[model samples]
Target: MNERLLPVLDLVSSRTADSAWLTFTARLDTAHRADLRTARRLLAEFGAPTTNPHEGHDMPGMVTDEELAALRSASGAAFQRRASQHVRAHLEQAIRIGSAEQRAGVHPATTALATKVVRTGSAELTRLDRLDRTTAVNRDW
Candidate 1:
């Protein structure tokens, strides 16, 4: 999820003119990237590969190649709208997955990471929700 989300967040930050949205995306990008790094390191310590098994799968909030192309092709408002949708969906799914991992995962480090993911993702989701509401009221996109 972080792997997928990072690039989209980067794209959105580059395209969005809204200062609030930029700030939110930038912070999220930093946190998610850190999470991904920690996760990869944890897997490596256990002799497990860090490669994503969900690649090309139609899982919830998994962004498609076509969607990525659309995002890449779009400019300004179009990009912002598409990127916002993708980011929000990804955050929601990540929180859900993280919560499950926290409950079911046996590894102490992995479960700890999951707990952090859930906490951070939930906070960011609230921030995203507020940004969405503000954008909707402004209708600037």
Candidate 2:
């Protein structure tokens, strides 16, 4: 198993179909629908060990039951804040792991996937951050 890939795989596996993830997806605007779908597909791909023979064994940073409970209970802006924070942290970790994998000279396929994950995750994070800022500004008025 690629050490760099483990954290992301674990996160994906833990989050897929989980209540918090479902709630987050449900709350997202139509503008974010495509991105949410892409993220889910990517997570499914990473979570399936049989689909990627090189991957097995769990890693750190899997979302806990407690965190899911919190997300489930949150509403409106609070939900967005919580979901955005989690997404940002996940993206940041993916970026770091992907960069490390690139530096370490992993398999070309793995490297490519890592690159794609980082790029897509970064874009999503930026979009979410922008939305958050816009919401905050609107609330101040």
Candidate 3:
């Protein structure tokens, strides 16, 4: 593959492989996001809890009596407001880590794409990180 193709393939292939490795990572990620949404909805339905327990398959575990009390404290039409605040905070942390990684030499910044000078046909490459040892074939190619 050419220069442009290599990085694109590398990124896509990693995601594809990772997606398969963790079968439910993508699904769980989606559902985790949905938990925050459900949290809001549950806030509205807050009764004495003698009515509906509000349990679900993908919820963020059992809410303590204290937590229910906290959510109850917020007056007004505030539905699922806690979920929104928590989700935003979590996403902000992920974004900050991503930004730092981008600033570091990890990514091929700008597609200005300086040659990384990867040496081919090395026995060392064959013995490297991946236990699958695609590197042996890498040297062959």
Candidate 1's error at 76, in angstroms?
2.9
* After superposition, candidate 2 runs with Cα above 4 Å error: 1-61
- Model 1 pairs in collision: none
Look at candidate 2 and give me any clashing residue pairs: none
lDDT per residue for candidate 3 within 26-138, as digits (tens), equals 33244334443443444455432332344332233233345445544543213123322333333343334334544563434311121111211122123222312342243
Best by lDDT: 1
Best model number under TM-score: 1
Which of 1 and 2 is ahead in TM-score? 1
State the lDDT of candidate 2 residue by residue for 33-120, as single tens digits: 4443554465576674335432343334234456656766665556556655666666677678768877784457567666765676
TM-score of every candidate relative to the true structure: 0.91, 0.57, 0.25
Please report, as a residue range, the 10-residue window in candidate 2 with the lowest summed lDDT. Answer: 1-10
Which of the two, 2 or 3, has more TM-score?
2
Model 2's lDDT to the true fold? Answer: 0.53
Error of 2 at 79 (Å): 0.8
